[model samples]
Target: MKLTPFLAAAAAILIASCGGSNDALDGPSGPAMGGGAGAAGSAGGGTGGAGGTSEPQDAGDSGEDGSNPDAPPGKTAEEACKTYVGAYCSQLGKCSPIYLQLIWKDAAACEASLVPVCVKSLGLPDTAKTPEFTASCGEAIGALDCSSFMGRKVPASCNPPTGPRADGAACGEDGQCANGYCATPLDQACGTCASRAAEDQDCDRDDDCAFGLICSKDNKCTPYVAKGGGCDENHPCEPGLSCKGAVGPTKGSCTDPAGPGQACDTQQIALPGCDLNAGYFCHLVTHVCQKMDLSQAGEACGVVNNGYSACTQSSMCKTNGGMSGTCLAPANSGDACDLVDGPYCVPPLRCVGNVCTELDPAGCK
Candidate 1:
């Protein structure tokens, strides 16, 4: 029932392992689009997450007001970080008051804590700041209706601003690339910028391709396999399709997530059957699809008989050596953490005992 497109579409395999397997995540404060440790502006990244820093930030300080005459033309990445969250929450409040209620104490609380959460996720350094596309990004998010916001069909304005990195420069995030493309190999975190390969060209991941194609078994960027097509770790499926295998069907095939009230195996990891990102889970008693109960960080939480914790995505009910537990907020990478909560560690990093540790690159299967 661990679902939330907030982390790598909730189902896509990623380097952050939960329960000792590759389950890509959008950290409690993970970016909106891409799941693995991508910055807010990276593909499949930017937007949404759990409670942020302890201090409640002033919403007006996000550079939204044209009060600073001495300020630069565009907002800095650090400033834009707050602006993005503020706009997103403000817009979502129009459609999903329930979600906002569960995540924060109130709309004002969301702006304060969540804004800092977004800035931390982007790993902003107060010293090394740069201009970013702010007005358009905030406007695009603020303009979204419930449907578009839920689907997270973010506009291109939210992408990371072009940085100083050159084409051959080594980078870990798209924001570091001047061309806005960081072609990382599947086996590693850092990659060279602007290494786009044509179809049929040798590649290790879809990022290596120039266009809409997947890297096949032979390491060629080719058309993605269609839904219901044969698939495995070696063969890639088309976008939005999950390659799954279950007890009844041992064969792997590209399949769509089960819709509302559809049958599914709640126990199967590769084929949970239900579309978790869409806010559905396989019910234990009815054995049918159902919506999940939301429990934001800082709220009370507990493990029911079935082993499910009500904490929101990227967070966990931390016992902290007590009988009762409270959901803890997601922390930054390299920060202190407890092993109980996924949110305790930032995206791409998992809590290992008392510290957040990076997982193996191969874990992002």
Candidate 2:
């Protein structure tokens, strides 16, 4: 079965809801420089970061160990992704966060799972057997981001050629509604344009409720509770609201999750309380919920008691430097990386790169 972009995007959302950061990304390290002739079947112009393979050069293209020892160590993951993924989708007549989210999953496995599917769907040679393909895949895959993809609109290319239906008109999908979403009234197969329902109005989906209101457990629109107001998983507050307390029948009150300089739970080791959606995370030293600063390649990271705050989420600060160190990309085979807590190498490739490589590996085993 051909997987649609919508399916890929939905999978990303599912993975995120299961309690994972959808915002995993390799910090931008700028595009690679250097050039040879363009290759055949290239997705975008054979630019520095826009990786693509040339015509079959040898048996390597037949699907064996997909490693391009010859391919220039072009741009890092972040650089290549910023160039191609967006361009590839736009060229295919679809460009939006929906597709972007699908391209960049919350973790390496999530992102890797989609690579083969994307290669096959796009008709590219199996990258595993082709060095050129591998080069393109690495960069394009590395630069995926969760924050950038949220709340993005479906591009006009993906929408029905005919404009959306008017309110009260029968609809089956979000694209069919004039407002870009369908609201099920009475649980019918054919929904209608989700007019924002006022307080106490019937509602089946959150979008059906008017601004400042949310759908309660009883499926009725209710005003969103402010700070200290009662709240739970089902009954959520406005954008910045965070329901505290333990998960169960009762959560807690809706309050400001965190502010720019306030303390927060970044690693989520504390209370699982901070709203990650708001970009709130406890900084290593301060443990405050503030936007993290991105550390570029070779920058100091992993300061003492800083909780790896100095490094970007994707890169790791070398372990040798106790208090401060350089932020470098995850090591490959026989390369150096942190073995202490959670090693950052892509799965199957163990933390100690020299120790293990996927021998007879299949799937994410």
Candidate 3:
């Protein structure tokens, strides 16, 4: 039977599952199977049927040979299969049952030739719970037999288990928690039930604490207690009020003291005083004040002051410096000398051998 159609159908299924993004199989034709039929036929020339090939061997054909140089040393057959399958799947984009069967056949042929690592790598576990391998050689050659492979059966954990826990708790061994257990130092028990505590829990660091709390140095959960009265580091008070130590020595409270000419109205408690110099209002919440006019501040102050333009506001000049002035260009002197803040300077002030000289208005002095 032609296998090309089957291969195409399988490939199409995989491509569809992948959102039909692959353009490699866009051609009008499918893979030709008869091309390799002759090679297999020659290998089985002595057989009766046309296009016949020697019968593929079963797992029992090759017994374990620990000391055999032709077999992979210190490696299990399933492990080898995982490595080979991973490599093959990387090239094929996806692993299919047929690909596994082909790999098994190829591994068997290599084993018969006494190729080292081939047989041991392809051998399946005898205690496989499922009939992973099919009886038909053709069917077996093109199928993934994962029933006996440990990597396929218990894929969550390999020989040495390590990964995230399914229950959202730390794990260390198979017995720690139930599903998807991972080995970790914190969770010594392999499958111990984890607790959802708000405080005094086993935590590696502060980041493990709840949303508003932090892990303390003693491994306890502590709320972000702000200092001075209001919002602590965790429960920050709104803008205009700062977290300060309250009446008690250890407690904190959010409060805003009334400024000069300002009333102690609770509603306007967070309102900031107007900076006559800077022309900006300070945000009590973040303790940061903003300028109202940045261009004037830039011109009066400097271009690179605090990443803000000095001319942002006219008041910035009065606050930043005692000088209340606008930007001005210096007057020019004809001696190639630097200009200074002045109305005008004498002309024809040429540099004579490094000495500046001002020409007499009448002619030369």
Candidate 4:
């Protein structure tokens, strides 16, 4: 079935690098290159989804690991889910502390927040969890460096346990498929197992490829374009680089994004826009990319020279058909959003009938 990568949103968020220094990217209240105060967060504060934190927080390495003395013993698959979650969150927390701070309170809270996601996406059914796979999975996750962690790379050991279902068998999850791929058709809930595609192989979607490869518009599994390489809507550039001059048959070269005061337009992806990872957004009003004051939650936004973003990563701009909007936090499931600050609920949760609601979890489904 035609499918998108489960980490598609995460991939977009990767443009917001965790660490970098920009002269126009100082803290809020500081002087910017062209006009207004430098924003508190980096250029990608409003990029939304995960990794919205634009500036580098440097919260230090998350000390916990599967090997930590105080860590829980993952003797069962259920417990191993926790171990895997901890290993992932630990590295993520240290990569961008401020973003996590905006959501959960601490490392433990962060782990708690993301555990269900990891478990639901890559884990076995509650009745199917086994310990033999748990230990190896947790250890593999704990060994991931920041690059792999940020890329959402799945360790070989972390793959779902092999099952009796053969390729082409009806399956609801990866664990049920012998080939480890459940080829769900677009807009369908169920799928069948299929063999994975390799680089240069024909493919219809991202999930058909093996690790580190993505399906291109040409319907082939290919590696991501490197920095300074030509790319377009069909040819995606590597994370941290933006495409410039990509239009029609002529491809654009991936280049470092523009900094604050640089000319930009969100409508034009081919242009060398602002540094998205730094929390710089293109201001439609001024037609220039500018840093937003991330600390300006509850403050008015969308005004003249206010940049595309006025709030922190966790929050969004809520404009109710007015000339201006306010920055506010997201609501939880079943929470009333009528009086909330942002326009909508958090990622993975949407405003359904004015209440935040959960959607299908990523992967397999």
Lowest summed lDDT over 10 consecutive residues: which window, candidate 3?
Answer: 48-57
What tens-digit string does per-residue lDDT give for candidate 2 at 1-365?
A: 01110111112111111111111111111000001011010111000011000000011131222233444455543333333333333321221221222122233433343233222212211111122333343332233332112211111122111214566765433333344334432112234544456677886433444333444567776654456776554554433345555257755665555555655543222332333332234455555544433354466554433433334323445546245666555444444433333234432233323231221111110
TM-score of every model versus the real structure: 0.47, 0.31, 0.19, 0.57
Worst lDDT run of 10 residues, candidate 1, spans: 50-59
Per-residue lDDT of model 3, residues 262-342, tens digit only:
322212223322221212323323334343223321244322333222221001122224323332221123323211111
lDDT of each: 0.41, 0.31, 0.23, 0.43
Q: Write the per-residue lDDT of candidate 4 for residues 1-365, one digit (tens) a residue.
A: 12221113122111111100110011110000000112222233122112111111111222222123333454654465577657645654664343334333456864565455435543433112244454455666567664344333555554444455688766554555555555543223345777668777987655556545556667776665667788765665554456677778888787766667877755445456554434466666666777544445577655534444445433545567764567666556666543123334443344444555453423332
Candidate 2 lDDT = 0.31
Q: After superposition, how far is residue 86 of candidate 1 from its true place, in Å?
A: 2.3
| Candidate 1: tens digits of C-alpha lDDT, residues 139-231 | 556765543344323344443345466788765444455654455432234456564466678765433443334345467755445577765
Please list the Cα RMSD from the true structure of every candidate, rounded to 1 decimal place.
11.5, 18.7, 34.4, 11.0
What C-alpha lDDT, on a 0 to 100 scale, does residue 328 get in candidate 1? Answer: 69
State candidate 4's TM-score.
0.57
